[model samples]
Target: MAVVLEVDSVDDPRIDDFRDLKAADRRPDRPGGKGLVIAEGTVVVRRMLDSPFRPHALLGVDKRWQDLAPELAAVEVPFYRASAEVMAEVVGFHLNRGVLAVAHRPPERDFDEVVADATTVAVLEGVNDHENLGSMFRNAAGLGVDAILFGDRCADPLYRRSVRVSMGHALRVPFARVPDWPGGLGLLRRRGFQVVALTPDPMAPTLATALTGDRVALLLGAEGPGLTEEAMTAADVGARIPMSAGTDSLNVATAAAMAFYERVRAS
Candidate 1:
């Protein structure tokens, strides 16, 4: 069972992992950045506990701790109990979520392992926005998409903001980086997945008509840029979501959700 430790002082060294999160949780390449996967709030923290990330410590208020007590019974980490005010001071912000958990980043899942049993997956390119990535993972989880594969220039989906925005789906959903950019997509193709690129072009077929494979991989790109021409060319087919006359495109995450729904509807 997890140990409950009272933390009255904001300067307690044991809770350092939860301190000054803005700077400490930055990308691993940045100075003072640990690249730890931090889960905020009760829901996300719960997800992290159930995920492979394996949190080493948790910091939250007494009420939040009580709420998570059942789930933490099997966990072996220290649960640092503190007042909301001290938590705010430690995290360097007023966190309304009232709970936090920190885990060291695990090894990235292998691409083959991520896709081996997936009948449907989402592939991303240049989708660097953290919120969009989070929403994409949430949508994927809700709509039965199997896994997520990262292409070129994608943001870390496990970034703190992404995990929070995902409502912890980022922790539940399995994902892996696709090697070699557009060329790597060939692996999916060779594995019998029909790669469909989501585009805004009017000439492309609708997502409903283009997705016909027993195994499918939907490709998405950044909001303004959409998929690179090279990525579009690599796909087995280009598909679009029907839209109103004035709108040229949808937000990447919204578009992804629509496509994911289409896959679910077809199944």
Candidate 2:
């Protein structure tokens, strides 16, 4: 059972963890840097309550607290109630969701473990945009990609923005970072994954034709520069989504969704 304690002061010590979220993010904390996995809004907060990232405390307005009551029952933490104004003063912004919950980051699973039974996985390179990273996870979860692998220069999927963008799917999806650059990709190959580089090159075969393995790893790069020539060369094959002749390539996350959908459309 959880007690809902009202907090009127902007400087309440119990709610200190939610203060100055931006500054706290860079305060030399290990893991996700803020020493916490923050969940904003009613939806994400509920997801956090249901996720492996268990909340220790929550700060929200009266209405939001009422909305969260059912989910909070199983949680052992206190819900620090506050006015929207005071919460704004503490976090340095007017949070529309009027609720927040945070949890310590759990231990990271090794890449090998994440992919042990994966039939379809996404490998990202230089996809630094947090929203894109988040959307990719949402798409992966909805379309049933087994897991996501971060190759190099990717954003923190646990960042507040990423989590919100993922609509809490980021909390459910499994991901792990790979070591080394193109060389790290060899590990997937040795595990019998067919490494297929996703590209915009019209010369490449369509995804429908090029993907021909039971275990497939789609290698993706950031939106603009696409996959590097080095990475393209390292793959077992190159694949392209069928596109309109003059239209631009899809956003990286949207492209990933399309690819993930293709893998599961029949099933």
Best by TM-score: 1
Per-residue alpha-carbon lDDT of candidate 2 for residues 1-267, written as tens digits (9 for 90 to 100): 779898988878888778887565452122545556788899988887777788888889999988988888887998998888999998888899999887777887799999999999999999999899989988998899999998878898887888889888778888998878878889999999999999988999999988888999999999998887777887999999999998989999999988898788889
Cα lDDT, model 2, residue 27: 28
True lDDT of residue 178, candidate 2: 85
For every candidate in turn, the CA RMSD to the true structure comes to: 1.8, 1.8
Error of 1 at 80 (Å): 0.5
Off by over 4 Å in 2: 23-32
Against the true structure, what is each candidate's TM-score?
0.96, 0.95
